[model samples]
Target: MPEIRPRSTIVVTLLCIAGLAVAGVALAYCVHLGAQRDDDTGQSAAEFTYIPPNQAGLAADDVTPESDEVPEQLDTVRSKIMLCTIDKIGTDVLSVHTPDGRKHQLTLSPDTHVESAKGNEVADLTTGDLVVVRVIESDTATTVDLIVDGRVSSSIPDN
Candidate 1:
């Protein structure tokens, strides 16, 4: 049997304590973030539900566990909804600018749905129209699922 050195034991004890301290700090930070409130809705930020990209058109209550368990497509990532102004239009693509001043070029999927006061087709959309877009992002592509003209919808909040 070999003798245990006092220095080795001290070093091991100090490493264990440091690891515990780091873990505690990380847990406290997560709790703090979860407790933070969203000023606009007067709700906790953590309460926001993560809607899957394929189900962006569905209401929060409409999403079912059965659907969520099986994704429609593979390699698809997260989804997001944005209020954007149409900057430019193409045959199958759109360039839009968000309120935050960022510009994005969006491609419409073959089955993309468009709702507007003017018409339901993509040809009816014009430049400078405010639209609420629900988009699904993937590693290989960014696809638009739904587009609603903000003028006809009360969903767009007033500043």
Candidate 2:
């Protein structure tokens, strides 16, 4: 018959090797996962996560279920509004200087809103007039609203 020590030693060594092989595979898989980078940010599917501005809850690392609903578009439109003073005015052109001394010559849309302290028209606009200009910009159209002297006078919407 066979010697017991040789058979037992062979079996123990084989088992130990198999166990080590499994452990090595598990460690390699863990390292692979750790080396992965997150490239899903700024994608439309993950954009506009509905986290309100200045609201605190549910950080990006929190696990979330996969949603089938269409993601909302982020507000990349109407990104800024500036209060500017009229530097120059013309029939088809309007120039304004912002408080930071940057000047912009805006093309006058046929439907541009020209408002003032009094019920005034574009011809009534004069140099040094303080105007609140709400600029609307989209992929196709750019328009502006001219509100003079803080009166709720006129607006340029969706044009």
Candidate 3:
């Protein structure tokens, strides 16, 4: 009925374009957040391998103890003893403290298995829980295999 005003048409077009720009930005941010969450999930899928103390040069034959001379294989030893404080316990990974008082983060992958007589203790672990973790150094970082005793209070004391 009434004539369409040129100024009104321009204003409407500008408002529509601004709304679309805002929506685009919001969508991009959501995608970025999703990608970050996926990255964390991938990290938790790392595998673990156990290296015996003898093979790693930490311990010689139990029956026959070698002299104090360090073996040549010690240079290749990729595992270490670490006392850590549980900073965070996630669905997959665990944040721990290194012996030097620095925080060393460790991942709990599907292959990163744990052996504990104490059941469900892993899930109930809280921040500040002290744990002695045996970790094998890898290309990316160290991966935990055995939870050494004397750290977790819930564990039964060794005879």
Question: Could you tell me every candidate's TM-score relative to the true structure?
Answer: 0.50, 0.42, 0.41
**lDDT for each candidate structure:** 0.85, 0.70, 0.67
lDDT of 1: 0.85
lDDT of model number 2: 0.70
lDDT of 2 by residue, 20-121 (tens): 999999999988776665774544432434554444466767655546233577547763566889888877777888889998876667676766766567
Model 2: residues >4 Å from true position, as ranges? 1-76, 138-142, 150-159
Arrange candidates, best TM-score first.
1, 2, 3
* lDDT tens digits by residue: candidate 1, 1-159: 998778988999999999999999999999998798756677676575556677778775774777566444555488999999999988778789999999998888788899998899888999999999999888777788999999944566684
Per-residue lDDT of model 3, residues 84-152, tens digit only: 788888876788876677987776666654444444346655677666788788777777776643443
Each candidate structure's count of clashing pairs: 0, 0, 0
Better model by lDDT, 1 or 3? 1
- Cα error, residue 51 of model 1, in Å, equals 17
